[model samples]
Target: MDETTYKFLMGASAFVIAILGLMLAGTTILPEVGLEKLRKARSILIPSYFVLALLSLVCCLTGYDRRIEPASTLLVASFQALLFTMSMLVFIRPNEVRWKTVFRQAGVITVAGLVLFVSFFRFTDYYSCFFYSGVVAYVLQLIIYTRKFMLAYRKTVQEVEDYYDDDEENRLVWVKCGFFSALAVGIMALSILFFPVLYKYFVPLYVVFYSFMVMWFVNYYRRMKFAIPVIAAMPQEADVCAIPETVLAKTDGVAAEEAVAVAEEAVAVKEEKSGAEHLLKERLQKYIDEKEYCRKDVPSGIVADSFGMSKAFFRQYMKDSYGMDFRPWRKELRLREASRLFAGHPEYTIEEVSEMVGYNNSSNFNRDFKRMMGMTPKCFCKQFQ
Candidate 1:
């Protein structure tokens, strides 16, 4: 590469970095999602970019001296290290991921990377091997998130045509950016190792990619208008690392909104489920009272059908509403009614009373009543007498 070309690239990158630093410092770069973490991230971003710009200028100043290349490499490595550290702060999930954990992990990565660079470049004269050592930890972190994103993407697409959900979809935004940024880093690192000449231009190029991805995440997340629920469960994947191109951007908002309404029947899932459960309880109670359904030899199907609900859902409703299974609860109600009949209508024979309550045989009724109520029917009646 010619000196003129190198100077031009470095000068351009420095100017761009300076502009981005000013934007970060002024907090004018973000869209206003009303999230405090991102605001705090912008606060940290100001100085990090300024330092990165300074480092780039220093590297450009010492470009002619091959003897000082190791120092330049170390400086660039330090900048990369700080880049990921700031990234960790920016994307740290308040509840799902801890800030201290990210800080400690970034610290360890920086230390380990510096140690490897020193050992390789100074001791063994292998300057190239020190490359990408700074990024290993953050890349691994992104790889983990990438896997999560792919799994989520696959699951979401299974039910729908695209990946735009209003509920918790915004949560995956940063992870998607992480996946792309990590891919760029991996490619750049590999290219520099295999083709040392690639480093001359690839540094500026990869920096451009990295900076755009970071800035996009910040602005995009801030504009992501939705409530963040608990991070949805990511489906398990074996060893898949396939990255599809730029998924979250091309989603059809009209189609997605329509699909969500159709998927959930034009109601918020929580609100719909809540309202349905409440109605189910009310209707079931009304059915039971009007028909004395519990006193009948009622099949679960009959009881559920009377309330116009599926048997399975009715059982779930019973458990959720009353904290017991449907059949046992019906039996308890029947036994109580039988006790009331025994006490009030003493002249009615046990067989007659049992038959009225839908019992086919008095002996079976007495036995079940004894088992549940701890007394025989006649004994129960005697006490009432």
Candidate 2:
């Protein structure tokens, strides 16, 4: 490419990068979601945009110098690495990530990338080989992470499913789309290795795509109240089914009378808790028999409140007793009601059955029915006829 054309391309990229950086800066500071982990992850984009802007500046300064090309490749690789790291922070459980460890790893990566950039350009005669090797490494890492991300994505979807009955809205399936889109765009960006001339055109498009993704992610998660309760070390209430080991241990040195009293008190507490659990179980079964779960969009908090329990405790009780989360357990009740309706009222249409069973979306109802019953609703109904 001519010097005039190269300068114009670099100038345009610099202007675009500056605009993109400003937009990212505004969002990072005033993100729509108040989640601390998400906010921290978005903050990483601030430096990413700056890295991009700096890369554009460097390209302009070096103006097609083949030796400096390796440096530019390394910069792009580093940016991609940061992006993948940010996504890992976004998808994983907030408490699972250690930001200090992440920062330390990032520091190591930056230093290694710098060393490679300088060593290959200044000392080695194998600049071309180094550039190709870097590209190969980046692609290999991307492929490996993409597979890992698939597993994480499925687990996240299952977590969401465990909370919300309406799988159509709550399953974080859109995140998978966003992930693969970014992967495609990253691959396109790396194509600069083979087609350097197209970089001038591609960079602007890449910037715009990334900007759209940022807005979509922020807006969607802002309205979503996604939560997965962490398990506690001990039950919150003093009334528990089992006595703490500490209680029994502390009785070793006590007088025989005191020890007997402690043992008797513990037994009383245990019996009280056991009776309460049995009563709760009976009340819940009666609630199910009445088909209270057939109500549309009943909040779990309200359901728990009716039973004089907190939502977290109610959910834990359901999991422990039924071997399933609240939503899944509710789903089973709904589907069972639907099956009964199909058998007893064969005149009912699929949509009617779905609505009666608390499913607003017939498509989702059919999907879930077929998955559980191993046949579609229409086919299931025909069995009775």
Candidate 3:
């Protein structure tokens, strides 16, 4: 087969692989046990993957020529533009399902796409510039979008861990899967940009990476062993035996011995209860001290596993003991840490401080800080200064 055909085939393979991976990752029937949060995430990612796949096809069909037919150029450029815009909107306004941002982004993408599409035929000399510039712009936007998504993922994980009682295991599955998916996409982008010649060769690598993602989802769903609720189980109080006055009066010596045995058993039960409580407290403190809970995206399953408790039980414990849900608790912890970091670490920038306290966006950091501390990071810093 000719080089163009080979490239097209490779692109098609990548597209197929990406689609299959997304289906596996998102579909409930794929034997991948994911929580509701993960399911929602998959819903977003599946379409994103398809857009990326279409872009790859466009690139492959257009070939490496600077002077391509106007029709072909339009197809390639239009797809790239659409892909870039959709990615940005998806990254930014993920929660808004009305397609408002999607439509807006699509408009921008179409304008840019049309310019390149028409320019290919109208001005062959500038084809390289148009193509390369559009690619670079798309890549840049993708990088920003990916970073934002990663941050959002972390926050979601943290919220899941703090608020939900059951499905701790499932939460971790989703977080880890999402993290690796983003990482894989980033790596693919870097390879395509920096090593264009090797792009065709990397088809197998993409296949492998996505295959693992699918497998992970399938395995996680099948196990589904981590569905313990947080508040469902309370420690039972030990029964205290009451002795009748007649028995005690008639038995004399035997009665005294029986009473002593009962006292010993009661003492043992109390000690056991105290020890259990102490162990739980120590575990909880360790979780806090490690700073894992501070991550915006940490899932409750991870924390529950760390404490050797079921997710439901952990949720109940946090509610009963802390009197707040997981998200609020994490927010409170992050803000407190951000405050301390701001006061003590004068050398760090506000951005750095925000990241250290588990914030992905500086704007979010500032907003959360002001809401919690009643001032911006700069103002808070002035107090320490």
Candidate 4:
């Protein structure tokens, strides 16, 4: 094919990709529209995409006439305009701040983009001013959007934390996704500032960035795992689900008081039965107290077996009473014992102290010590001297 034909094909393909993106975004939002309004918006956007595609193809074929090209430019420009308008509309509607704020920020960008287009219209004569203004506007929009997104994300994170403490793993995953989404949006906006001079190259870069964002939302919705249970009688009211009795009991003062009383009574009755149990607990505590457990890389399962209890039951009991799993509890015990040893036996090097604490690696010991004490073990020991 000739050079002109190749350029035409390339421009047409880019326009098609843009249209596909627009179609995806459009369909995703259609469920929110009133039935009567839906048909009208779809009609306008669908035809606009085809018309602009054809116009872009024609401009490429006819040697890139500015007037002819501007039609295609306007088509591209209209995407931002629609985005801005939608953002403003959502902002004005009640209970739509998330959508509204997003769109409003987008709208500001779209309006500023008109200035960038005007710069391109006079690119040869005022190239520097055009580039600077475009870059400035893009940067400003990125900052505004990033701030708004982070604020909304923090609000959502707190809500998630308050509502679902049990599913902490999923909540953390969503928080990470939300952070990356904001970062992606910022990167895409920054990429656009370069598009005026290097339009052909960065076009695909923008497309891929946006595609990843859409995929992120899809993944987030999928990973929320637990279902919101349905309630028939209170159709309008929010659904409720059963919380673990143990979790609820901790917070209910009367239940907690009753539990404590029952625990004391049980302990008194079980004193004779608990001679073996007390001996086992004491052995574990002594190992920790003497720093022997820290010196050896002893598994909690092995400890439980030595004490004549199943590892599972031992883990459950420790978790219920102490609110820590075996590994962390043991680590804390070892670290505490290690801290004392390190302070008293100043002749031992940091590496020797680490080995004594059951940490195979000095770096790991240092990290754990700093995490628990807010300082390195050596620094912590120096305070005494």
Candidate 5:
């Protein structure tokens, strides 16, 4: 492509990137993530990214193009900021290890600062050194991101070794795919730097590559929009799931007291019974005791099917015997098992427990956990520790 075409392409790509940034900025209220540090991290990163995209677009549109020093600085700096911002995001995901994440963020930032400082000194001899340095820095960032992703992948496999959510596992697989795709584009852009003689010819290529990165970023943003709430809610759900009897015994309000009384009566009937209700309870209890309901997708039909019964029959039987339907009954089973797991393994995180109990999304787990448990997972764990 000619210089005119390349300039237009860069400008157009920048505009698209700015729009993506705006879309990302549109969802600022993350009721999922409870940590102030994470909240601050996202609040800063999104606005900063949006600002950088806008600035780059402005630079591209102005007479001061990529060949010029000022525009080049703005564009390259924007790319570097994008890389570093994403790295920090990985550090802020709902993980059990905060110190490690903090250390990684500090290390990446320190290294980035040093690289930028050194590249600036070399900038006088070679203007493209600024972008060349950006490519390398992004490579380093992808390395950090990939490492963190690998750790998360391992956690998904090792912690919940037996149970796996196909959809959840599929999403985890995409984590690597997204990072690798960006890294591959980064490498393609970086390799062009070696052939500085034809770098202008490749400038359009850079625009395409940069656009690819932004597109991947949009995908990440979309994923997080849903994932954050689940991640935020995991702990509360697990802890509340841990102590069912204790949770059920408390009556903070009239409605809660009635609910607790109903649960108690149900329990009392189970203890003092030998009829259809007791028989049904025995069959379901035995199945639940065997850790069968740990998968979050355990529908009543599926469970009943396993026991050679129809979904309708099971649902009616559960309602008649315990004044409840399948959903609450299954939740009670999960909570009891999760509580058992928490009491036995105090070190187990909400993430781990949520996974074990079949919650693929931590945000949903956390929300449900709080709604039912009345306390966060971390708070519940602390009571024991």
Candidate 6:
């Protein structure tokens, strides 16, 4: 690419990147339950892009088109580090983002990256060595980030599975796609530094890719904000699934009340508690026996309401009694019923059996079945035959 053409494209890239920053700015109101950190991350991100645009314009004007200057090197390294760190903050331990620690870590890393960046700069003959070494370090950094992000992604998937029965919408798959796409873009961006022949192609591609990333993030955040309530109302201490009558009978009465009053109060409390527990248990058993879980995807809130229990309390109850979360428990029930259906109705297609077992998507049904049963639906059917 010629000097004039490269400069024009770089200028356009800067403008597009700045516009993308503004697009990110518009999503500032997307923070929802358990995701306050995303707002802070976005706050850092918007300014970072503006800084990127300024750097781009500066490099373009100075004819440091190949990015050989120390200033350009430092700025690019800092931007890449910021991107990686912010991504780690969002995905790894989202709620526990400590700005002080993050700043400190960034400071330490910046010093180290500067040292590596200038290792061969003083020796003009070894500039090639310096450039390739920097690329090696960038590749290593990406490898580390990818591994950590993948581990975090797996944990996030487990949490999503545990919390939502359907889980189709809440899986954070877009975030994973964005993360890997950023790494892929980073590789392409690095190539532009090595081979100026590719700069013209890459600069425009980077602008389009980043704009898509910003939009994807905004859409995902908006969906998350709507899917999860802003505040989960925790159940009060008095609110419980099944309070034991024995515990209620031992509570002290008011100072003015005599022993007889205390006894009478305890007896009334025990009767009320017992009656409520009996009714709820009967309803719960009926819910189970009638195979209500097989009808459709049921959220914990609905299940809790049917038992006249709070959502939080019901989740805890499931954890305590069943040693698993509601989704997994419900999944087991549906899968077992599916197995039975598969054995009895050899004529049923995998999709038909999946729908009968409350799985709206056959793909999810296949995935879950393979995960649980150690084989595909087709393979399982073959065993039955």
Candidate 5 residue spans exceeding 4 A from truth? 28-30, 33-41, 58-92, 96-141, 157-168, 195-281, 284-385
Model 1 off-target regions past 4 Å? 28-34, 64-92, 120-178, 200-204, 210-218, 229-385
Better of 5 and 6 by TM-score: 6
User: lDDT tens digits, residues 259-286, model 2?
Assistant: 8887888888778657757867987988
- Candidate 3 per-residue lDDT, tens place, 73-169, comes to 3343344333433332222233422356545766776787777777776887886788777767666656665565566555544433444421233
**What Cα-based lDDT does every candidate model obtain?**
0.56, 0.67, 0.56, 0.51, 0.56, 0.67
Q: Which stretches of candidate 4 lie over 4 Å from their true place?
A: 1-111, 115-131, 167-201, 213-221, 225-385
Best by TM-score: 2
Name the Cα RMSD for model 2.
Answer: 5.9
TM-scores for every predicted model = 0.46, 0.67, 0.41, 0.39, 0.45, 0.65
lDDT string for model 6 (259-360, tens) is 567677678877876676566568767977888888764666778787887666566667876798778888888898999999998899999999898886
Cα shift from native, residue 326, model 1 (Å): 23
User: Which segments of model 2 are wrong by more than 4 Å?
Assistant: 1-17, 28-34, 57-67, 124-133, 136-155, 161-170, 197-205, 228-274, 289-328, 336-364, 372-385
Winner of 3 and 5 under TM-score? 5
The positional error of residue 336 in candidate 4, measured at the CA in angstroms, is 23
Q: Compared with the true structure, what per-residue lDDT tens digits does model 5 show for residues 1-385?
A: 2456545655765676666556555644434453444444445556655665665566456633334443244335435434543543453244544645555765665565555555656555653565566566556765765676667656653332212212344445555555555555555545444443344544455445445444444455454443444444453322121112334454466586688777887686555433544556778878866877786554455576676555555666778777887777666667777777888899999999989987766766666667677977777787778
lDDT of 4 at 100: 52
Cα RMSD for candidate 4? 13.8
Candidates 4 and 6 compared by TM-score, better number: 6
Q: How far does residue 328 in candidate 3 sit from its true spot (Å)?
A: 16
